[model samples]
Target: MNKVQSDFLSLLENHRSIRHFLDKKIPDFDIRRIITAAQSVSTSSNGQAFSIINVTDQEMKKKLANYAGSQKQVEDCSNFLVFCADLFRLEQISQRLNVEMKKVLDSTEMFLIATIDATLVAQNTVVAAESLGYGIVYTGGIRNNPEKVSELLNLPYRTFPVFGICIGYPDPNRIPEKKPRLPLGAVFYQNEYPNFDEVYPYINKYDETMKEYYRNRSESKREDTWSKTITDKRKIPRRMNMKSFLEEQGYPLK
Candidate 1:
């Protein structure tokens, strides 16, 4: 491989979500650039149906942290951004332009499009933030109680808070070590898809690698593997009431 390819691959390989950060604020210019990177990400049909809210109010952060399962990072980070799937913006534009928003707004396809757009843009922001020496952690617990979160953010009917991201300069002392991932054999496929037998072994091997990772973490070490962790996670129905929440937000999922 060429030097450039190797260096870029190394950056991709070393990614770890930063939960603990120094109490330093990111500069406004850098924040703008990071958000620009997010905006630069391609969207479905160029709809750009997503919006971000940067929560600067400390009281609001504290309230959001409590709402998001008490994740202290939400309150402690230099910047906290809520990425929302926003059809309301487009709805207003359609109304101004004399277009029929009803044709798109109330469908499952619109929900999927907004969700994909929001997630992709946020992921782009993460890479850009890391490139500029900032640390970040994405919190999906923002969905724990969506109605209250939506109300707190003053979201319109056609909007839903998908996730929250905390950004800041990394605290050198609190940097987390990178964990292992599943092998290519488990994830990548050529022309045809491999059946379970070919992929199952890789998952087992990844579990072994994750066992070491969990055991060696600087804080909150555990005696579990990737498989066990996933199993335990699945035992509980995560986001069981999200349907009702989404319905409340004007997405009956029809």
Candidate 2:
């Protein structure tokens, strides 16, 4: 295989979210370089409609730890960052350039672009951290209390926390295992989506494999198969009022 292909496969094969961290600190220069790598990602329209808040305060980290399902990584990690979908910068630029902020921020296209930019940068940060032998975890639970996070961060209108990330040296005692993924054929298709006839059998096999994996890995605490887990999750109502939350954050979703 080509070097690029080999490296990609290695990264994919070994990927896991690290929740346990050593108590050592990462150097500030290394932190800057990691964020620089994240900033190198291709941005939508070169607008770069995203920002990251570097959070290092112990008290704030403890609060965020509580907010993020009591995930220990939040308080134990060397660094925490919140990636934001931001139109606030664009608004400032429009004001400085004597253009209308309304012309840019009042579009569904702009909102989509901002969200994509934030997600892309966050992924890049994770990859960069992994390459540097650092453990990292994404905290989607930041959105669980979006208003509270916004208030804590003093975020202005037109900017919202997309997610948080924790980074640190990996703790040897709690090394995570690679989680299984669905077979490539089950997800990727030639052009149109593959029919159920071609996909269902693979899913069934995968479900059985996953059940065994969960029983072994999680000590049977989670007995349900992947399909059952998804079904159960969907049966319960999620914090589905995100549109109202966005509106509160001044994103009208126009």
Which residue pairs overlap in candidate 2's backbone? none
Residues 144-234 of candidate 1 have per-residue lDDT tens digits of: 9888899999999989999999999888899888877899999998998999899999999999999999999898899998989998988
Model 1 is weakest, by summed lDDT over 10 consecutive residues, at 7-16
The digit string of per-residue lDDT tens for model 2 on 1-254 reads: 99999997797579788888999899989889999988999998788999999998989989888877788789999999999999999898888999877855867788899999999999998888888899898998888888888999999989999999999999988886677888887898898987789998788878987887777783234676788877987898766877899988868878
Q: Candidate 1: which stretches are off by over 4 Å?
A: 1-4
lDDT of each: 0.91, 0.87
Lowest summed-lDDT stretch of 10 residues in model 2? 215-224
Residue 8 of candidate 2: its Cα lDDT? 76
> Stretches of candidate 2 above 4 Å error?
2-5, 218-221
Q: Give the distance in Å from residue 49's predicted Cα in candidate 2 to where it truly belongs.
A: 0.7
Candidate 1 CA-lDDT value: 0.91
With a 3 Å backbone cut-off (N, CA, C), the pairs that clash in candidate 1 are none
